[model samples]
Target chain A: MKTVKVGLGTCGISAGGEKVYKAFQDELKENPNAFVLKETGCIGMCYSEVLIEIKNGSDESVFYSEVTPDRVGEIVEKAILSDDTIEEWLAVKPDNKQNFIDNQTRIVLRNCGIIDPGSIDEYIERGGYEGAKKALTTMTSEDVIDDVIKSGLKGRGGGGFPTGVKWNFTRGAKGDKKYIICNADEGDPGAFMDRSILEGDPNAVLEGMIIAGYAIGSDAAYIYCRAEYPKAIARLRQAIAQAKKKNFLGDNIFGTNFTFNIKIKEGAGALVCGEETALIASIEGKRGMPKFRPPFPAISGLWEKPTNINNVETFANVPWIILNGGDAYAAYGTEDSKGTKVFAMAGKV
Target chain B: MSQQQSDNFKPFNVDLWKYDGQEGALIPLLQSAQDTYGYISEKAIDYISHITGIPAADIYGVVTFYAQFRTKPLGKYVVKVCNGTACHVNGAKPIGDTITDELNIDYDETSDDGKFSLLSVACIGCCSLAPVILINDETYGRLTSPKLRKILRQYKRKVKEEK
Candidate 1:
């Protein structure tokens, strides 16, 4: 029962990995009980398109590059069944060399490509909502806020504001009704890190937002996803519905006094809507233009209520910080920039 | 309602056919339409406008904003000279000048004989290989004036031979 994994990340898709995946499907249908075929996300060696990793009983995992539909049969027959590993297609032998994941840490992207995104059980199996459960059962809202402040986890969104500070501001604002927003409107020309996370692991984001709502005392949340990301929006909509059915979202989450609700707001392809102030305006059905910030969103946002806004990547990190403790999560990345940052890695580099 | 009234409106309908609604489609949409229809014309603009419900003026604004969107018919060969920051700094001006001299046409303008069209792009992101030129997406980098001239001559010869 050896596993053969294919990198089906965005870069792989653009490079024609879909055809390769279909070819694998057809080949595996011929021999159903022979081997396990799995799909994973990018390994960051985007220069090598259609990456395939094969693992057998006694042999270490090997990666094959530039794989196409034409080479699918050859790969399954020669690489999977035989002893010889193809030399020409070998991009990097990762047995001892930790080129991709050595310097990098996977907190927000922990479950990406490892589990089926559409399944809540898959997410829970990978330790998804343990943080929310821990918060509801043990810690108070103040304790969660304090831990976040200590972690120094700044927003992965471009502005780089401290996440804890934003939460504190929303907490201090005088309002009975507060709103939490996940700014998934990633409009940076080459940036798809947010989209990938939303598509690959929507639960991580939902869980993070639910925790934020608890910490900030917000009862309502809105995910401002861009209209361009149809796939991401569909996955998120489905994930939200699944979470609600599982008692992870909606009224009395985990049987606690906390009750929160989330909705999706789609932007009409406005580039400036990625900005926090403009995003807030857009979500409120106003023109997607940036307004002067004196009070900021935390004080006066989302229909003039206290609001907390964080990007998809920032929210994804929240659940991890709560579950693993702030110190463990904060130990990685640079001093000011705590935690790993996910880059789209487009252009020549 | 009457036969006389229908006949009177027929001339207006014929006048509308001259205008294609492509002028109302956004830049990307217009580019797609152009790619579909070999070239954008008055007929395309009217067709795009009729389908999209956008004014021809608005579509024209978008088409002019993007460098890739062309209003006129292109030549047999499209030579896109890189005028991006790196190429410009590394003497892309001379290459552009040489292209205009050879083709006897300015940027975005097709040659009189419809043999070639000259265009300049901001950046193809091939900065390491500065002074790059792409002839129909086949990038030729590290180009000097003489090398560019030779490449043009080779293309011209190939075109002539094919003819």
Candidate 2:
């Protein structure tokens, strides 16, 4: 059968994606189960939101942009029932937009705008948690750290600290208990990539954290997400519950002695909490204020215990790096910076 | 406290019991209290401070520190104009100016009629739809002065129709 996917990210929803989805639902009621309707995250073509993609079997797909509720009838008639592509409404058929998608590599956003974020089955079908399983069952902690170091992945949170080296510090630190934190407090203006990743493919970040916990000998982790993005939080909650049900999270993961748990701490709309120290302080229920960082979070952080914190984008890249090997990731970008980075590309552009 | 005042925030008190002993629960708890009641009232603050044992002064500090926390009761429609970099570049100020002019209220001020309140926010993360304003949870984006004026009129029409 054919499937109709609607982009329902914050950008899409703000553009009346829900109305369009509802319109399609009303239209499809006549022949129920004739075509499947699915919800997906932002495709990064947010400027042309309310994006609708019609997939005819496996080989052919048509992308329509700037869609409205009025267009749904014609779309259902032409694209779904009649199997005719809407040439004028095509996002890929347009030269500039198609070039935009053609000229870039997408590792972190591989699953975004494609799969159903709420469905763990869709995620697993696309090879989601294999990296975490591989890291836990096959690779040693030192080996995983070495592979990450070799891959040249740095903190995408603007600090540019090496991920493996940071993990090693927590690993070497003298502490009875250590913690891992995923900083989803994307407070910077004009940046919604973190929100998109959390909404689009939360499991990638979760899997990355599970691997990080195993690597750094920490069993507990927290995702410090801002409360502004309610959709992202809701999606993360769904993803975590699904992951736990499938034994992808929680105690004794992957039938190994390793145990890890992930929790979400909603931020109370403080932009300063985007900073590492301020974020840690916010998570601890104190007023989010930054102190000196001589003893970095890797040494003594989060209740004065050893802690490892990485950005949402940083963690989202981890599973890809683990599955595809560090060398494959290192091949992209400049000699100094490895892999790809997602940008907001907002403003007059 | 007056019975009516406490009754206004009865649900907050009922839900506030769960976070009694949980560490780092103050902010989330306060957030829920605000969500239950439109804004964090003085009585709500006192009740929260009494229950959490955090000083009223400290609670006020937290409430004032964060931009999202509203101390006063909101107008029926709270219009949040985005002031992010992209929105600023794309003339977010004129959009704000248009709303305030149409409503006859300044930024962060509510109308005398209590129908609308104008507020400036850092970003709503919808830069692609720059020059955006969120009236309640509904976002109106890519706005010009005329477009915004029309939106404000529609909201005013909503108020009139209700009356």
Candidate 3:
């Protein structure tokens, strides 16, 4: 069956995506059975939000641009049902964005625009929890850490620390209680990558956390996401519930003894909380001010336990690395950096 | 996590258990106070302090620290004109000036009726669509003076209809 996915990510919603999605709803009521109406997060095309994609039965999809509520009927009739082309309304094509998409190796964003973020089934079908399964059922904690080290993944949270090395510190720490934190507290002025990842591919991040938990002997994790992103939070809630129900999150995952669970803490309003110490303090329910470091988070973090912190973008790359082997991921980027890094890609670069 | 969670934020005097004794509860409590009463009211601060046990002075200090928290009541509509580099280089000054002149209010002040408040904010992270003005959560991007005026008129018309 053909489906119509609207870009309802924050940028999309800001660009009248809700109105367009509503328009589709009203229009689809007349011919509800004709198509499946779905919502997806931003495809990194903030410039062309309120974007609509129609996947025909032939597996060929067309993307429409600058869609308004008024244009709903025409798009539904011409584009979805009749399979007729609306050239002017169309936002070029995948071919047109080849330079944007093809120029970079997209490990982090591999499933961003393509999957229905609200659907765990879609994410699972797209190889969602395979990494966690691989880690929990097969690889030892040491092996997992070593594989990540070999992958050469660095913290994309602007600190650029080697992720595996950080994990190793926490894993070797003398604490019975350890925590993994997904630092979704992305408070940068113009940076929307974290929001996009959490909005677009939440399960991928969750999978990364599960693997991180397994690698560091952690059974619990916290995702300190921005409260400003209610949509991302809501989607993550749904994704976590789905993940738990599937036995991917709760005790005895994949019928193994390794148990892991994830909790979400909302960053009310603090730019400083992006720092690890501040984030740990905020999770402990205090002012999100940065504290002096020495023991560091890996040694003494959240709840004064051995805690590991990773950025949203950093965690997003873990599943791909584990699934395709560290060497496959190490194949991309320069010697300094091993995987594709995302930027909004403004200016002439 | 729920958008509905924000609805419970009325008057800043709910069960503090939801926020109290929990680590990092102060900032969210303050945020909820501002959300409940528009600006963090003195009484609301006291009530929050009473509930959270963080003390009013410390709460006030916290309220002053972050740019998002406001001490005074804002207008029904807050107009945030972006002044980030992307917006600046894309001719945001004239647009900001237009909003200032049309509303007859400087940045951070509300109009006489309290219908419209003006705020000049840092980049809202939508630099891709530079020269943006966000009225409430709705964003008008790639804006020009003409577009700003028209949207303002629409907002005015909306207020008039409600009145």
Candidate 4:
């Protein structure tokens, strides 16, 4: 099928890509035979918002900039149908120079723009659940922990805690009902990186959470997402339902005894709730406020059981690490900051 | 949910007198009224007082406290000149002066033609490229007085072309 990727990143969405996406969806419905419309998270050229990349089989892919609802028909007609490319709107020549792709690495966000967020099959096609499969079948729980440890992936949620160490601590901690939490409460000013990932490719995050649950021997997970993001929440809810339907979530996933389930909790607007301790407090239906963190969440968390809390971006990296060996994933970023960090890059980028 | 979330309160027609009775309800009531109508009108002030059971004198005093809350009708274009420490140091004063001179209106005043309104903001957090002014949501950064003039001229040209 022909592919047309639109930048549904926060910047693009703020600049009316939501309307543009709807317009394209409605337009493509009429001419379903020739085209397929897809949504991707930010490719980092935010200055040129509503960025669109169109690819047909024989022809080279082209990137279009500043796309609007009005221009959707023209882009569909010209770029998708005829060979006549619109020069005025083209941002970069995909064939001659992949300037957008070459400058930045895409480890955490590898499956972000490539996969349909709500569809599990598209995620599987892009090597999504291979990590969970490997973790389940080939690698032992200890081996999975060791791979994460060697990868040196730090939390992108401002804390910079070692993911492997946290998982190891949770594994060592004694508990009957341990839980893994994905903190999607991204309340930092000018930060929508978490929201974009959740909106674009949610299953990557879910798969990562499941892998974490498997490693720590947890049977349940909770994704603490903020209520402000109605769209992201809706997509995540749909993704969770889809995962359960495909047996990726409920009992005996992929024909193994490791059963896991995930539920979504909407956060009341609180900036401090992004703190893990505060997030647990909010999840327990208390007033959202931060408490001292000595007996951390790993020891005594969420209903007094060992809980692992990783941010949206950190969980996004998990599936990739498991699928593409830990060493391969570790070769991307600086020594101190290993692996790719997906920033919102808002305000003046 | 609090008692305020209840729908028993009338849609509008607030009394200004009862606003002074409550301590913190004044700001929220005014904010709710302002959010309903783009700018807080006299009718909204009456509505706020009627709903919150507070005095109008205290309600008006509270409106003057916050920079974001406006009493008068704002113009179509809200020209917010950044007066934060960085913006102030990097020639934001001159840009503000140019706008005041061109519009013949002081800060927080709308033009008689309803085309422009001028206000000073704390910061837009684009300090790297300081001396910025956000016309509506778009930030025009690294601004000199001459650049500000040229930008205003472009707006005027667009207005004239439309006319």
Best candidate per DockQ, number?
2
lDDT of each residue in B1-163, candidate 2, tens digit only: 2132244555354455467577777778777777777678888788878887889998888888777788877788889888888889899889888987899988888787777888988877888998888999898888899988998999999998977
Each prediction's TM-score versus the true structure: 0.68, 0.95, 0.90, 0.69
* Winning candidate number (TM-score): 2
Considering TM-score, where higher is better, how would the candidates rank from best to worst?
2, 3, 4, 1
Total backbone clashes of candidate 1, pairs 3 or more residues apart or in separate chains: 16
Q: Rate the local accuracy (lDDT) of all candidates.
A: 0.75, 0.87, 0.83, 0.76
**DockQ of prediction 4:** 0.05
Docking class of 1: incorrect
Model 3: per-residue Cα lDDT over A42-141, one tens digit each: 8777787778889988888888888989998899888877868888777875347564544656889888888889999999898889888888888998
The residue-by-residue lDDT of candidate 1 on A264-289, one tens digit each, is 87665566778889888767544556
| TM-score of predicted chain A against the true chain A, for each candidate | 0.92, 0.98, 0.96, 0.93
lDDT of 4 by residue, A251-281 (tens): 9998999899998877645656788988887
Native A-B interface contacts kept, per candidate: 0.00, 0.64, 0.40, 0.00
* Model 2 spans > 4 angstroms off: A94-98, B1-17
Compose the digit string of candidate 2's lDDT tens values, residues A1-349.
8899999999999889999999989987887877999999997799888898888888577789999999999888888888788899987785565466668789999899999889989989999999998899899999999989989999998899999999999999999999999999897888999989988898989999999999999999999998878899999999999999999887889999888899899888888999989988888877899989878989999999999999999999999888888999999989999889999877767
The per-candidate count of clashes, in order, stands at: 16, 0, 7, 15
Clashing pairs in 2: none
lDDT of 1 at A106: 76
Interface RMSD, model 1, angstroms: 9.2
- Model 3's DockQ? 0.39
The superposed Cα distance between candidate 4 and the true structure at residue A140, in angstroms, equals 1.7
